[model samples]
Target: MRALSPPVGLPMLAESDLVRQVARRLSDAIVQGRLAPGAKVAEAAVARELGISRAPVREAARLLESQGLLRACPRRGFFVRALSAADVDELYDLRLCVERHAAVAASRRLTAEARAALRRQLGLMRELAHRDDPARIVEADYQFHRLICETAGNSRLLRLFDGLASELRLVIGLIGRLYDDPHEIARTHEPVLEAIEAGRPERIVAHVDHHIGVAWREVARLARTLSPTPGGAA
Candidate 1:
């Protein structure tokens, strides 16, 4: 079994909270590529590394499974879920549809507060871009788009976007860097926000399409090379 990094000491908390912490550690490993795609999650090894019982590790794996980040085989236990280029393309297609409509709706219902929030998020993305952490950068990027969906005030749209979060994060993590410079990734959203501020539905949709479309093309191309782990194992 591969040794996994232990998270910070577990705080005194309820059983559910402990499970959540374990799940977070595992999820971080997946996002950071410490745990490669299709790698089996040795529950006992993880428990030993964290100095905890195996029960919580098992439960956490189940939680990750629900999030589409891990898969549980009949007798092979849990392994990181593997995604292919086609999967990446399809996921982005759904994302584009949801975001295009959400951006259009947000433009119609744009509020001062939401506008400020989006700008702050953009600033955070710019700041994080200069750093070496891809996960934080990707998170900031996701939040900016998420803000648009929230501003749209459509619960279903937001739910759909949230549903795609884990898989999208994994795909971006695999691609490593979407643009030549991380700042370029942040800059792509500038036009999207500008179009929204202009309060033009067609313009907002066009910018959203272009922003997401470019990422889709790049990620799909990269995913073709990485592909999925054969037989769902490394």
Candidate 2:
């Protein structure tokens, strides 16, 4: 995937809170291949480049390390994790399984407020997603699915899903690469949300299954082109 430049019109914050901001910037760089797999990350140089102290850079690397997006080697420094087709498939499949059940359960408890909120998400996603920018499309896609999981109303599952977001992103980003049609994605979403709001559990499940299967196929199709082997890289 190409480098995901910070979105236009993003709010600017100061450097006082450097750790998380540093981590986020570096994480975006890794995800977008500004920092490619196995590329060495130097804490001092990163700090120098960003005009900050090394403490935050080290902290950022440690954060990424915990997320499995970075690793340290003997006598070497941090490096981006290698992208893998198998890893993406397994993560996406697991997400599909969790979300399908959540959708069905959420349908049984649908409320007016939840329906309105979901409808808002679908609309916002449709608006931003139509742009040619993959980053915006992918960001909207995340909000859309996360909205579903929230409507599902399982606190534990929501936390679990949040924890797995980075892995979730691998396939979601791949989906944007696979298909250029945002209207298609947005159009298909209405029926799915409609079924959920109508309290049709069976239809909700089928809708969930359909969406996941379609998204999965797109990810699988592009992941193959990513080349499974990083070959001596991270």
* Pairs of residues at least 3 apart in sequence or in different chains that clash in candidate 2: none
Q: What TM-score do all the candidates reach, one by one? A: 0.88, 0.79
Off by over 4 Å in 1: 1-13, 231-234
Candidate 1, 1-234: lDDT as tens digits: 999976555453576798999998898788877887778899989999999999999999999989889988888789888776778778998988899999999988899999999999999989988885677877787788899999999999899999998887777676455566878778889999999999988888888888888888887787666545554532
- Against the hidden true structure, what lDDT does model 1 obtain? 0.84
lDDT of 1 at 189: 90
Off by over 4 Å in 2: 1-16, 36-45, 130-133, 228-234
Candidate with maximal TM-score: 1
